[model samples]
Target: MNGPALSIQTLDKVYANGLKALDQVTLEVRRGEIFALLGPNGAGKTTLIGAVCGIVQPSGGRIEVFGHDNIREYRKARSHIGLVPQELTTGMFETVWNTVSFSRGLFGKPANPLYIEQLLKNLALWEKKDTQLRMLSGGMKRRVLIAKALSHEPDLLFLDEPTAGVDVELRKSMWAQVRRLREMGVTVILTTHYIEEAEEMADRIGVINKGRLIVTEDKKTLMHKLGRKELLLDLYKPLEALPPSLAGLGLRIAEGGMRLVFTYDPAQENNGVVSLLDRLREEGVKCKDFNTRESSLEDIFVQLVGDS
Candidate 1:
């Protein structure tokens, strides 16, 4: 709590098969902030999370949780953290109440039925306390996982693809639960395929690509810096190809040449919009109408990872 919720300095992980999962990755998660780690599959998102959670050992560098070195003080560091893995690993025959209660005890916590009861209720699992995990639906089982994670009342929580493979309604419900957890002062770190999840929830986002952390910044800043805006012009007549004069102007023919799409950075002093319009006019290109659109997180992710 003195420095940050979690800190990793020059972290590196190399598997026995000579696969470099993480490459000198350094990151900091501020206290009480929702930090989203965005990356493509096999980009080491889960490997990084696994390292910090002590499930995977680092090959190099240090990881500190709340100012305590993770390796030197594993118990203390682990006690303050909770994890909801992407996998469903609960025992099929175990009742919801016993599963969560047992998880708390695994952390060496005393039996506090009141706390456990409230946690189960908060997750909407109160009515299903006596039900076996095998009988619960996918969504309800995910809720049980959440309750188990929070059984010890950790200060930091890690959710690995928390909403993967869930229905739209269930995903929305999970998002609400995450928001509630953040409101309760739990610093949350999540890895999600849904860029919208990060866009909607993360205060800050870190992008990892091919085992490297390519970018780390506040969500708004990341968007403002890398987000592209587009102006689409509807052509009066379709052209086979772009005019020669309009070359190197950052323009593209779309909709089978019935439209011209111009992408530019909004922060630039000259976004080339006027220049493009003037060039279009000089080229005798006729436009019936036009509209503008902003880039989404998915756009930025594709661009960044594509570049990598």
Candidate 2:
């Protein structure tokens, strides 16, 4: 438990068509932490996950899961990891219970009905255990996927876009479900199209772009380091233009020139918010209301991805 749940050092993956899917990737997932990997399509997020799960072999470097080398000790390392893939591969004719049970058996685990029962109940799939996969809704199918991943009781789980097409309510439900997994001491690594979901659930975030990891940091620390604060002031009257002294304070006239937006880095020693306020007073730009908003994870994500 003292070691990382998953670790990769100088990992590289190249495809037959000369596509470099992964390039010298290095990362570690702390035990029991929910680490979100953010990236665009074809950014190697899925390729990275596939390499660790053994579906795709790396061309070079090492991968260790729970202290076992993924290639040398494949069985031991794989037994501790469960992957919930983006695509559903289960047969349409398979019942939920049987499918999940089959997954456990594939891992060489003896049938444990009690554990399976509890798992199904926890994932809210108990009632649908007898139903075929094709008969279930998309959200229910996703739940079955999660149930299958946990069937063998893996210490580390990979969720590839767990709630990709889920409704708002279902997305929230999945967020709570993920939190419960963390409570059960299951380390989770997830990749998602929704940055806000990552913001809401992740303990740490890693931004991957162009098959390379650009940044990885604690959520709050990352936000503080890159997040900007916008102070929006609702004016009492519309202003024709900005004064010269107020120009350099990152001021922008918005809302049809009725509002003043002051953008600044909140982490700086002197952020210039006080100076902006003083300038507003000098210009007699009376504000009816003012509110400050910190940049969201989505904001930083967009900035980092840069047109992705």
Find the candidate with the highest TM-score and give its number: 1
**1-308: candidate 2 lDDT, tens digit per residue:** 59999999999999998899888899999998999998878889999999999999899989999999999999999999999999878889999999999999999999999999999999889999999999998888888999999999998999998888778998998999999999989999999868787789999998888788888899888777777889999999998789887887779999988999988888897999898898899988899999999877677777888843
Model 1 poorest ten-residue lDDT run: 295-304
- Candidate 2 minimal-lDDT segment of 10 residues: 299-308
Clashing pairs in 1: none
Provide backbone clash counts, one per model: 0, 0
Query: What are the per-residue Cα lDDT tens digits for candidate 1 across 210-284?
Result: 789999999999877777899999999998887789988888989998998998998888889988888889999
lDDT of all predictions: 0.91, 0.90
- RMSD per candidate (Å) reads 4.3, 5.1
Q: Model 2: clashing residue pairs?
A: none
Cα TM-score per model:
0.84, 0.82
Candidate topping lDDT: 1
Compared with the true structure, model 2 gives a TM-score of 0.82
